[model samples]
Target chain A: MSKSAILRSSIAKKYWMALTGLFLCTFLIGHLIGNLQLIFIHGEEGRRAFNEYAYFMQHNIFIKVLSYVTYISILFHAIDGLMLAVQNKKARPQKYAYNNAGANSSTASRQMALLGSIVLIFIVTHMVNFWAKMHFEHIPLHTYEVTLPQQTNPEMVYYTHNHSLIPIQVDKVVVVRDETNLYLENTDLKLGEGYKDLHSVVMAFFGQSKNGFVTNSLALWATILYVISMAVMAFHLWHGFASAFQSLGLRHKRYTPIIAVTGKLFAIVVPFLFAIIPVLIFIGYVK
Target chain B: MASKTININLKIWRQKNANSKGSMETYKLDNVSTDSSFLEMLDQLNEQLVNERKEPIAFDHDCREGICGSCSLFINGEAHGPDRAVTTCQLHMRKFKDGETIYVEPWRAKAFPVIKDLVVDRSSFDRIQQAGGFVSVNTSGNTIDANAIPIGKAAADKAFEAATCIGCGACVASCVNASAMLFVSAKVSQLALLPQGKVEAQQRVLNMVKQMDEEGFGNCTNTGACAVECPKEISLENIARMNREYLKAMVSAE
Candidate 1:
């Protein structure tokens, strides 16, 4: 066997899948931890904290690099999976008249391609609903209530990128349209900064216009889809987490059992927590 | 022990040839002895068919004790019927319930094409073995004693276990992707564990895996179905070992 290539194409392809898959799993943990703040923290403090976190995620250089890595990993994982799925389908050109795949393998394992495609769809729509809005739209900044000079009613607020609301003179404040920084009137002196209220966007996206209960038809449907997407994610992770180690040739009897148990728990806990966020928001359980 | 007989219906696949489309043909088998093997039950059906001047169902079987991997039948959606760690020849009729309908089909994979009813072209396995399943040995009369090379008991036992693979395509048959990783990995592990085979281990793994891909076998999804359905109860550890060997070979290659 005097082959020039050391690694076969299929095995090498599997290496890429395993690497990208494990990277995505790490991304999931980080994402889940950040989102859990939606429930663990409450009220205006929670909103500000979340908004600040989103800002840091967007602006920090290291996080920016990691985000790009995440994007690349997601794309590679999805595309490579699709290719492998097609090849696998072709491997059995003639379909079995009666196949009971669930007899020996897991339903999740057998239906990985189907589950992955669903999760991909969810990811696309999820990014559109959150990431695109945060990146592209001129989101309104966190508002602070202040009464105008010579006015008793407190309605107006100043927009600043400063995550927390600070005491400011509304009369002396000069605001530029679609700008993040607050300026002293008629001067270039900067007063404070503002942050994109991503927390509000996330809260509104989930069916909580003002409360925990689903307020509108769209919010109800969106909330349901969120929960469903999380379920799909759970199923995908069920087989994928442990399977990655196998694909990577990291299988050890002593560690494998622990890894498998950890995978199963991760499958249940992560998605359940993720689903809980939307359900709570939909029902107005938290701000 | 008293032997019991059970009446069961069979939905066996019937294909004229490789080019022709196959379909499930139903047959009513009466009073089949539960102690008889599944192949024996099929033999009874064939004999009856012969008496009725009907064509006998074509199937592959040898060494009905399950050592020879020639016997292949997808019984009731499983590689070797519902039972685990047994080949089709070793499957007893007692496993089936009375009045139950068993669905029997050929091992389905692009690499293992169905030649007739339950006989598939498993020459793919032979071809894979030919690729790199052996160590390069030259007859120059310079061969050393077999026991000269020391081998650990654990390694020896694991190698022996890996060597037990009967070259059955059951692993391919049961896999959702029809992945041959288990079969190929078993061969890779069997030799790579020995000092004699270690010399060319890198080349062996590379060529074997390459040949497996060229044969149109799907990549492993780590579903564990192959190991679950393997007649020899081959461990998934072999596949993992192969992966380790392959990657090491890949990076260390000159």
Candidate 2:
């Protein structure tokens, strides 16, 4: 009898919110660490590292489970948050004639619904830009240009996607159109495959490319939007991180201050690093 | 502080009844004593209105010393006026500038509708209390001695602190969401700590929170506004404790 009542209450919804919120916070850390590989390691190695990480994230069974959990977390967080916001709004049907909300609370804490909704939009656009393309479309394979002393021109070389030592010569295999398959030239028989060049897609996202400059007007706008969204994300986390702890009833007199400080620090540092990634790529500093 | 007086402007909310619409009416009271309590100053305004054959501005006040939880007012956009850690009746005129205008209104919340002017129907709190705010102790002649039950000093002190909540609804009035979480949490915490109340701890928290939700009060977002504006300076820890207790009950349930 009381079990359904517990689930239906505002506090129970917050319990779910706090649990999912904390889970997502951990996800942010993992995501940021993987993304930092973009700027931390330079040249082909960095590209290989990021692409390898992406491949591992996609192919690993454990990560696949975690990815599903992530998707569920995002959906549940957004929907539950929306429901709470609507309910909370209805709690005060009549607006005060004069309210000095600033005198008592933070602007970020008060505007969480707005900030979260914006972050939701950014997440949608962000998934469409990167996740959709990577998961659904046929992206180019990673191709390396290898030069030999006997050849005046550098030959096109393709490495196996499994990080194997074998390299395929350009003339030895026929490249399929808009696909990653490598076929024997003038024959129906197939050679192996090449790695999906997610590295190139990410690099070119901000106009810089492996080959040269590509004039993508969206690059500047995307960088700006990403940085702004990261800032909004930071603001969201500023109130949210420790608030999750409080909501979960983990607050202790000895540890709450530390948690509060760590929450603020986490809020600022993680987003700053994430924001810096695209900025560095756009400005050619990390390219 | 000798015989101080100051002239000030007032914008007080006035409503004929619950069905009638309210409006802020302006009044200028000259030579008001700075030594007067905020309620006393309002009494002065009421006296002036009576002399002019106008209806006296309706407001709520009782026990004028700030513990009855009756004198609820939002002054200058603050619950219980601008001064911290004090109720409206405890607020004095010396805190205000001589010529500055003061805004006065009732406690604002969906559960706490304005009765007339500064009086809000805080009976929602009473209803929540009625739900499960009490311990089911047999009051027969063979009641146990107070010292028979051993309680840790920490638990006793903490329970005392939670018990200090006067249910003024300042927490709701000052909260951006108008949540009554602090008030409910205090009630839950006070009883939940004592051994006598521990018999019904799970059900008490469950029923109280259920009634609290039924009251249409908003959810607590942990802004600390309620604790800041509370006349008793209730800690946010009580709300957290209530959350813990409520979760424990639910998880341990069949």
True contacts kept of each: 0.75, 0.63
**Compared with the true structure, what per-residue lDDT tens digits does model 2 show for residues A79-191?**
98988888889888777778887888888999888899999999999899889988998777664332334553345554455566455565654555325655656755445
Question: What's the DockQ of model 1?
Answer: 0.64
Per-residue lDDT tens digits for candidate 1, residues A162-204, read 5765444555555543357755567665665678888888888
Residue A80 error, candidate 1, Å: 0.3
DockQ, each predicted model:
0.64, 0.67
Interface RMSD of structure candidate 2 (Å): 1.3
Predictions: Cα RMSD each: 5.0, 4.1
CA displacement after TM-score superposition, residue B160 of candidate 1 (Å): 0.6
lDDT of 2 by residue, B109-165 (tens): 889988888788999999999999998766788777878999999999999999999
* Model 1 per-residue lDDT at B214: 92
Candidate 1: Cα lDDT at B229: 89
Winning model by DockQ? 2
